[model samples]
Target: MQNYFVGSDVGTTGTKSVVIDEGGNILGFSYIEYPLIMPRPGWAEHNPEDYWNAVADTIKHSIEQARIDPRDIRGVSISALAPACILVDKNLTPLQNSHIWMDRRGIKQAQWLRDNIGEARIHASSGNPIDPYYATVKLMWERDNRPELYREAYKIQTAADYPCMKLTGRAITDYSNASLFGAGYDIVNKKWDTALLEEIGLDPDKFPDSFPCDEIIGEVTRAAAQRTGLAPGTPVMAGTVDSVAAWIAGGATENGDMSLAMGTAGVMGVVHKEARFTKNMITIAHAVNSRDTYTTVSAISACGSVLRYFRDTFGQMEMLAAQSSGEEIYDLLIRLAQQAPAGCDGLITVPYFMGERTPVWDPIARAVVFGLSLSHSKSHLLRSFMEGACFALKHNYDLIQQSGIQMNWPLVLTEGGARSPFWRQMVCDMLGVPCVFMKDAKGAPFGNALVAGVGAGVFKDYSVAKQWTEIGASHQPQQENTALYRQLFRIYRNIYEDIKKNYQDLADVTGFH
Candidate 1:
């Protein structure tokens, strides 16, 4: 019998399951979506049970769709949302509602941490700044605000590890998730740094045992088998964060291959042959393996969702059509944007709809639409949206490159955002490099499977796994647009520079939290 592998990705809105033959062709895949709960403003969460169901549904559907026997599945892998703090008791049941990656309840704690830890010191120690988006501040907030809840919490795992724990009946973390919260997980040493743990005042023991991303921690248990419909005792590799998993799928190397994930927010990551960092950006172990490093980070909130917002709130016609026709509203937006030329004819947009994250760590930042003219139409507005998001990435790309890390390759692109040829070309034009779009742009699921393949001895390492698994299409940068975009990018940078004070003042006035 031939060996089959399964890669399960737990994304923000859904869990996706993909089955791959030994040579890396996707046999079949399935996506099971669950509704998101925004209980309060700036808070994002999921009922842990919802996530588990999503995982099980997607897996069973993928296996059945592939028409493959479960016994052929020799290995499994997982990639998950990062910086999500889910507390589970010793019995592996959730302690409380999980505070997802988008939760902002730790803002004040994050602010206090920035002052107490000092930005440069924290960066030097953890390769990350003190920020609310990280897991530590979330954990700190729980410990301080919900003391009894914290005491009752048995383990704190990332979004990816939690489901895997349920599958394997064990608790463990991969390098990618452990390092995100600035909890002193070291990329270079491949171990948790005790000194940094002391500095952050976290219990080292509370952290799940760290494993190399490709290491086989255990297998599917009878319980997980019944739930997910997989063979009991099938080997499941410890997984990495979604972005880390993506870097592998897209072939981001340490020298500087960059993968920009545009989902609810935008995340950019580059693998470094050597560990590296700059102010505001983070450097951590790659999700696939410890031997390599990745400077994982992002910005441009409401990135992909920004277009959805425009269509939903503004383009109500398209939104309704999208719902009825089973086509993305962005597809219509992209076609319209393509009708307009480069530069969107003097429209400047800042995709700060939900405030900025990476490159500029300003939580107080507000979304802006500038340089709009009377002649501008929906096409111009649509084009500017894509351009604006690209500019945000360019801003960070410039910052990440400054760390003096050489890119392994020019560009690596993968994500749901790649569904549009227009978006893919726009990124290439903006970044002035060829972005190889993985034809199978399933993002994290493909990445996690590659990790699992390595762990189960199907592949040798992250690089080798990527070499065979990734089949991609390339988009070379357009020189003319690059020149035009350079000027627009200058203005884009100036907007942030010109509006810093106003952002702070806005934060003061609109304490909406």
Candidate 2:
């Protein structure tokens, strides 16, 4: 038997699965795109069936392409974009479309949580704020608004856990995903704290069963086998949220080294041996479960997505020209940006197109462009938007540093936006930190593979992760750009403050629903 393993990543736009051998060599991969439905401005939903179907198609496609015998497939691991609220009945049927991590419809519930539970108490216990961005708030909001849906929900789950239950007829989630909710989980002891749950009238049993990371939760079922190409009885390893899985993919096992991911949204995370938190930072449980462990995380709601906005909305002319000329539009955008100086000649952008999350919880926030003049062009707009994300990242970075977690700038395994030299240099120049290009730039898929290795018993621990990971090039900061960005950051901070009343006014204008 060949004994290969598969790692699947449940992405917002798509689900990707990568196959690898015991020796850590890439075998083959597959992906299937899915749609994110925005029925309302603050709501983000996805059909769980879409993700399940994508998983099946992608896995079958990967296996067929890899030309590997089905018998050789050893173990399968998973990760998904999470805090996704999926209500399940006794039969594990989904109650509604998955409420994604980006949904802000739970804000009222989140505020109620903070007010009743106390922000400091919850932050200290769970390591995250009581925001709609986490699973707990979303679940409570669903319970309150859709009583019919809530009444039918026997188990509340996320995108990842729903699949797990479908596969094995058991609904369960890992500690890491539970910790991300931060309102109910006892991060220190790594359990669903009943005292906290009692406060909200939510019984601990109302949620899905929780497991430690790396624990073999169950085996694939006959129905799941039909939905997916995997063999019935294939071991399913307890998986993690996309963020923690991305950390595992980036080799962020040890404390201090940061993993900066900029896919649709942006995230900065540093894994620690134990749960720790500060007012400015949220600590989430690590997917690699054990006592004394969690990840410190800070995020910006919009990063690469803003760049896409600029390319699609503002720079459509240049994008069309490049695409028609058979040139990479992103590459063309970078070239156009080079014509502008480091600071875009006094242009700055606030990337709150999706509203601010980390370091600010204002859902009414709007995007803004500073210092725009008649002289500015498409290149300036493009560059300013790109640089603006970095500035936003820096704000989170500063807050994280203040959280008192001392991380050595030894190595930062960056993925997503860091892949582009344009994006990487902007981060380097803005933060004055040298970010090394990662060897295995694959995010959750790669991490899933490593964890699959552990599941297959190829390696006892995550130590051999180094063999699976590699680094390519390096980018150093420019001193002059550093000074310029410093001044810009001060102004960036002021921009939010100056517009705080406006954001509040917009909230007031919207009225109390």
Candidate 3:
């Protein structure tokens, strides 16, 4: 007689699925990673078929691992990377690969919008800035370059909506995801800005209708049930973006609550009761209260991706050591980083390998390692790399504060990077804030399951997520480390200001842009 729910996160790099009981305890979990298609420089894409297959596979695997009957599942929900434009035909077949959030090929389109439509007008309407990161610019790029594909498309779908359509045969988006569409979704009014869309020369009909994040959109069809191993009639909720889901799972429900999700991208979400839209951050409707609350977010283009890049590009010796010894290469790298002292002996890195987002919004920005000396070892470089990411985060936080947003103390950190105590402590020192993380953090899938539970009436409300989340560890800022980091952070900020113009020059000379 116990009820269970299924939740899945269709991420940029992969999909994660989990089965949890009514109590929010994860009983089953599975993750499947797919390749990020990079056809050209600054372009990122994904095959829609890969998303559907991964969603189905992960759901089946998680259900099987949970040892539970699919019929007992009350509901299902999904979280996904947002603002991805996937064009589908009448038969729900993708016309082409999706242009994901990381794709920066729409720079010209974004610039056109700023010139013609006006950046302030667009930002005022959508609560998002004019950037290639938005779906509107990407769609413009598609319409301009791939006119045939654009003409043949029936509807535009996001990474989350595509999977939900496959599950329930309904092409719909949630408010949170819809706000980031940037094609004229009015975040404050909670409606499509028809005038804005028309001014931008986009067909408003191409976008789907949006619902509340927890609204039960539809039930799984027989074909979807066969594919996902769920009950044919199991209800599915319209879910939010992956970072928002991770924020919910980290127990951030009330106004002023803050969370940091350290996935491939570092996303920081701050929940507020009023719609305080700032150009410094991306604004979206809160998954918990779609109407009254807003979650403003700042994103770093690369966080864990930078670490992975280092491991793949520079950690050959550590990788070989791991092959010889039964150990994780990440652990070995972290061990090496631990050998270095605070501030990494005057070495600093600006982690802009994939350009940058939030506050800076620089598309041509590249990574920089400054103050490198012969005395600096690989360990020092490794540690400095980590500190660099933290510095970028602090940069965003400082800007957010300057914009008159009050941040709640003891920020909650979640996802992969938060799993490391050393990294967590580094964040504490860098941000100069006490931080706590959830014990046995379940990531976005857990929050998706909670959304399903709410929609299915298995739980009273989302506040239960906090009751279910148990704090694992807490770290206070080390006064000495915080002081040193404050000094280094200033230089980190100055380095970007000094060389930001050079990034574009380098790109123009090399034709990388």
Candidate achieving the largest lDDT: 3
- Candidate 3: segments with Cα more than 4 A from true spot: 320-327
* Model 1 quality (TM-score): 0.91
Ranking by lDDT: 3, 2, 1
CA lDDT, candidate 2, residue 504: 67
Candidate 1's C-alpha runs over 4 A off are 253-255, 262-264, 316-329, 462-474
Candidate number that wins on lDDT, 1 or 2: 2
Against the true structure, candidate 2 reaches a TM-score of 0.94
Q: TM per model? A: 0.91, 0.94, 0.95
| Candidate 3 structure, TM-score to reference | 0.95
**In model 2, which regions exceed 4 Å deviation?**
410-413, 507-513
Error of 3 at 153 (Å): 2.1
lDDT of candidate 1 over 1-513, digit per residue (tens): 688889988888889889888777888798888878898877888878777888888888888888899988878888887688888888888887777777888888887776776776767767787778888888888888888877888888887888889889998887777787674566566676767666667666667877777788899999899988899999988787777776777666445666776665677777666666677776667764465656656555667877777776668777777789998677876777788889988898888777777777666677788988889998888888878888888888888767687765546665667767789899899988787766765567777777777788877666654465455677888899999999889888898788878876776687754
Residue-by-residue lDDT tens digits, candidate 2, 130-177? 788888888888878998998888988888787777777888887777
Model 3, range 1-513, lDDT digits (tens) per residue?
989999999988899999999777788999999999999988899999999999999999999999999999999999998879999888888998988988998999998988898878887888888898998788889899999998888888999999999999988899988988875888887888877788888888888898999999999999999999998999999988988888888788888899897877899988888767877589989889887778889999877777798898899999999999989888888899999999998999999887899879998888999999999999998898889889999988887777676689889987778888999999999998999976666778998998899889888788888887888899999999999999988899999998887987898799987
Best TM-score among the predictions, by candidate number: 3
